[model samples]
Target: MSRLAVAGARHVVTVDPDDTVLHDTTVVVEDGTIVEVRPASAGPVDADEVLDGTGRLLLPGLVNVHTHLPMTLLRGLAEDVDLQGFLTRVWAAEAAVMDPPTVQLGATLGALESLLGGCTTQLDMYFHHDAAHRGALAAGSRHVTGPVFLDGPGPDGLTWQAREELLRAWPAQLAALGGPQVPVAALPHATYTCSPERLAQVAATLREVAGDRPALLSTHVSENAAENADVAARYGRTPTEVLADAGWLTGDLPVVVGHGVHLSDSDRGRLAAAGASVAHCPGSNQKLASGALHWEAVRESGVRLGIGTDGCSSSNDLDMWQAIRQAALLARLTSGRPDAASAHEVLRAATLGGAEALGLGDVVGSVEVGKRADLVLVDLEQPHLTPVHDVHALLVFAAGRADVTDVVVDGEVVVRGSRSTRVDTPALLARARDRAAAAGAAAEAS
Candidate 1:
């Protein structure tokens, strides 16, 4: 068992329901779980490793509830293209050229970027998700992966048969990890891409794999305007209504709907009633020209909200700090109310809210004793973050990715001094660059 201690932090934002902040505190971790969080008066306990959190703001590690990890290979490839043009020109081209090794390499690089930026956990959806799982493990970060299921064949021949095989193999693969194992979730892609029959099949597959245990279900919903219109045209119902009709909202299964930007009032009510959660990707939505999400309405409807970067391909970065800042700004802009989303609320959405969305709230998310010791230390000595009057405000508004000095996940120091401890950054970047060059060549040839 590994023992670690983090001491002398100016403030530790727990993000717990009580909104507690311990000043000049110390946190002790044993065997990947937090054992104690007390004031400096508790004294220094024995530990194999000691993290100096002096002049730093210690907070729970950020959780990204929705992302496409391997798409890091396609970052900035469609910068000037609209959503449709991007899907047709950039995404289609890259998907055709992405192979297993490239996918794994890209995912590994993406994980490294996330870790350096203070993200410890990410819920990822993409083809060849097994490689993504391996990449996350190799990077020493926690991730939940699911094979994307669509009506037609996706990259890597993600047909219905392949989807079933992936689902069947996921549990044992996760179990082999020894600890919590990277849990598997079911991703149906979207209502526009999957048929009603395929949606029902996805639900059945989730039930089969879960079998008296809780499971996660995620899908893109109301992400694009055309998707909403198409659903209504085909089924005479909204996307949420169509999903409900297909029984995708049933059971005790946890569902995370990504990009609920254009959800109607009834849809919001249904999501609240079904206890479903939403992943608000403000950066991606704004980048793709998708309308702003109704953050105020969603919160008032009692729906849990999590922040996501979506993917490097769309948002062009995996930095959760940027995502957090963007989410706060966008929420305020959309609501037209200066007090709509406070810094504290945005930070909570990035941490505990994301954990709840992914069904891991009981184990991780906050700095409570007995919870997993997944935390980040932000350097408060930076010029931009100087003279911090409000810790939460500085965290959400002023802090950038470079402010993340150290990150610990599962009692392990995965990132120290804003660098990855598990991965070779130079080698990973070289491999990723090589893969991207090869993919670009292939795209041109095709």
Candidate 2:
């Protein structure tokens, strides 16, 4: 086990409500867990490596609670298409051409991009998710994967059996990788894509496989107006209500809903009662012209909120900084109040809230003793982040991905000077370029 220490930080935002910020601090990590967080004046402890965080802001690594990482291969491919067109004409078509190798390469590129941009963890849902998990591990990033479950045939006619096989195979793979923290879960793509019976079966399987173990269950719910209307028309209830009927929205299951653009008040109540979280993909929603999620309502109803970039195909990037800013701006716009969403709230949404949504709060969210040592150091000496009045404000508004100086996950430094430690960036970019061209050709043919 490698022991590491980050010392002499100007400020450390712990994100713990009781102890929000630690000034002039040193955080010590041993064997992947945080060992001590003391004043810088306390002197150094034993460690193999040390990170000088002078003139930097140390905080918990940003968590992206929802994303389709493999869609990095499809970034900018459907730029002009609306949500429906993007889904049917571009996304579906491109997915057909994604074999295991292509999917793994795309996911590896996406993980590298995310790590370089200061995201240490992501909750990803997509097809070929075993490859995604492997890519995440190789990139030295923490990820919780929920393989997509559809009622009918998927791209390449993949059936539930394939998804089941992946799920069964991933646990041992993750264990072998020495990443026991990564959990594999079931993701019914959406209320529209999965039949009611199929959804219930997924819930049942998840319950069986994850018994007494904390697990995540995620899906897209009530994303578009048409989806809400369709669910209402079919089941005489909203999508949330239908999901509740199918045993999806229960207290025992740790559920996270993606998008959630058109949730009804009743749906919000149900989510609140069930302790379900919502992944607010503001960038993707704005880009796709999907209606904005009522952030105030969701928060007020006691739903845990986290920020996500969604998929690169819609959002165009995997930058969590951009997602945080967009989430704050959209919340303020939706509430028609400048003070509706605070900078600190948005920052929390990207970090601690995201960890809570993934049910990894106790282990990875905040910079506290006993938690995993996942941290990001932002260079505060930059022109854009100069004269920081409030650290949270600077992070939520002024800073960009370019301002990220270092990223550490599981006590290992995976990014230094805005570059990935585990991947060959030039090679990954070249492969992605080739795969993107092939994907584009396939979409056009379809």
Candidate 3:
């Protein structure tokens, strides 16, 4: 087994059960699990690889609970529009350019972007998730993705029959992708896009195949007032109620919704009771002028809430740092309470809260002995980070993506010295640029 040691971190923000913060700490890793966390007085750690963490803050790798990986190619495609307009314009662009190879390439670019931003794991929903896995392998990031289920002809132009085949074969395909095993999502697009019968069929199939580890079903829910009105008219229920009636909210299979922005009080209670979670993409919601998610209400409802960047197509970036900050700001602003979301709370939302939401809390969320060593180091030598009065405040408010100097996933270094250790950065950028231009040309032609 390989060994790695992170020595002399200025501050180790262990988002542990106790929310502990250790100073001048050393973390030792064996194989891919954390083996020891030591104080400065505990003596040096001996290992095959030593990462000097001095003058830097060490943090558990951030988790992005929701994303559409290949939509990196579609970033800025339909910006400054309402959610509906974004879908209409962006979907057309995606249809024109997102062939198999392009999808894989875009996923690669997105995976790299996520890694650079200090996110180690992501829950992604998109078509051609087989290709998304290929990109994850290249970037060495943990990814949970699966086939998307939508009624009518979907974005990929796959028939309903073809989409079902993709969903049915997802298990074997996901298993074949080598690396640490991750959950598969039975991702339907939304309440409006899927019929009650199709939702029931998906639930039954996934429940049987998944057994003890039920497949986490992800779908967009209660994104905006308009969507809520439509669902209320058609199903005579809130989106949450529509899902609940179809048996999506009950049972062992985890329900991970993309947005719970407009969920009513009863809706939140129902989801909380069913142990479902929400990927709260505050940044995306605010950017699109969608209503703020009632964060305090959701927290009070006992629902598991995690931060998400949604997708680059809508949010235009996969910066978890920005998402974390936005969650804090939005909660305070919308709730009319300055103390509504503390720095520590938002940090937890970005880290352990996100992990638990995805059902991976046991493995990758925090820096604990016997847990997977998904970690990040942020450089503290900068002017902005100097003389930190409060570590959590500085980290949550002042830190940016460029401050991330190194990242490790599963005890292996994937990023070092602010650059990807394994990815060909220039090549990836060139390919993305070339493909994006080609897509733009194709869009104009069509």
State the C-alpha lDDT per candidate.
0.85, 0.84, 0.87
Clash pairs for candidate 2: none
lDDT-wise, the better of 2 and 3 is 3
Per-residue C-alpha lDDT of model 1 across residues 244-352, encoded as one tens digit per residue: 8878776377789999998988888888787899999998988998888978999999888999999887899998988898888887887899789999899999999
User: What's the alpha carbon RMSD for model 2?
Assistant: 1.5
Give the TM-score of each candidate.
Answer: 0.97, 0.97, 0.97
The regions of model 3 sitting more than 4 angstroms off are 442-446
Model 3, 89: alpha-carbon shift in Å? 0.7
Error of 1 at 280 (Å): 0.4
The ten-residue window of minimal lDDT in model 2 covers 171-180
Residues forming the 10-long window of minimal summed lDDT in candidate 3: 437-446
For residues 1-446, write the lDDT of model 2, one tens digit per residue. Answer: 77898988999989987638878899999988998899999988678988888999999999998898888988877777667777886656556678888888888988888988889999988777777778877898897885688877777478878766655665555566665275557887888888787788888877777656677789988877888887777778887887898998779877899989998888999999999999999988888888899789899999999989998888999999999998899889999999888988889989989998888888888999999988999888988888978888988999888878888998899998788888988988898898788888887776
Residue pairs with clashing backbones, model 3: none
Supply the TM-score for candidate 2.
0.97
Q: Highest lDDT: which candidate?
A: 3
